[model samples]
Target: MKNLFLLLLFVGYSQAASACDCLMTPVRQHIKSTPYLLKGKVIAVLDDKNKEGRDYHLFLRSIGIQDTVSRGYSVKIIVQQDFKGKYKAGKIIEIHSTYSNCDMLFSAGETYILFLHKAQGNLFPTYCSYSNILDGSPASIDLVQAIRTELKSRD
Candidate 1:
């Protein structure tokens, strides 16, 4: 009986750990699917409590918790370069993101590549997408180059 209990406990823990698993999309595919893909620096981070307060609630089902624990954050970014979007350079835009495990937490003064989706007149990014901080690393450079190549091909 004890062995069976231990096995069940392990299984439950495994499920919880795998709750936020993300299958990152390839750059080419992400470019095609994402509505706004821009590289910019975050200028401000504020609570999303304006007209569209609490965009959505993420429910984690692993631990059987049925409460909406995460709130949305609005990140203001200054467009330095427009990779694939209507926003021109030097324009400031606000993107709504959640603090859930499967979402992004933006910080002020950090540069990031945003793979945004338009929903209800708001732009947001999912944790499973190719959006991430641009830290001048090889992975960041590779992604930017891939986006550039794909955009040129489309043109």
Candidate 2:
């Protein structure tokens, strides 16, 4: 009986630990699927009341995405109002995900590549998206180029 109980406990813990199993898709595919994608630094993070009267952390000027159809126009990416954490200003982080287990996580002053999607007129990043810290890898470079290419093609 003791052994069985121990086994069950271990199994439960393992499952909980592995809850966020993300199957990463190719960067190009992510670009094609998401409406907004860009790279920028977080300018500010504020604690404020959301529209629903609920308390949430607002990432101010979180990141800037340029309008594909309009030159010299940019869209400011504000993290969804449900996010709960402290994000320091001037941190460069990538956002890729759809509000699932893979939500936004940032370290101050770190550069990242982000993948953003449009949902109900708001942009969100999830853990499942192909976003990561900028490690100067060829794959990261390729992703940046791909995003640039796709944006240009839309013009």
Over the stretch 7-116, how does candidate 2's per-residue lDDT look in tens digits? 88876875465356777787567766764454554433222234211122112112222112211111233332111133334333333222222345544444555665
Error of 2 at 144 (Å): 1.8
Q: After best superposition, candidate 2 residue 15: deviation in angstroms?
A: 8.3
lDDT by candidate, in order shown: 0.77, 0.47
- lDDT (10s digit) by residue, model 1, range 1-155: 99999989987886676466877667788899887889999998776444333333322334454335555668889998888879888999988855555667667899998888887888888457888899899999998899899999999
| Native-to-model Cα distance after best TM-score fit, residue 52 in candidate 2, in Å | 15
Instruction: Give each model a TM-score.
Output: 0.73, 0.47
Clashing pairs in 2: 95-114, 96-126, 97-125, 97-126, 98-126, 102-126, 102-127
What global local distance difference test value does model 2 have?
0.47
Residue-level lDDT for 129 in candidate 1 = 82
Candidate 2 has a TM-score of 0.47
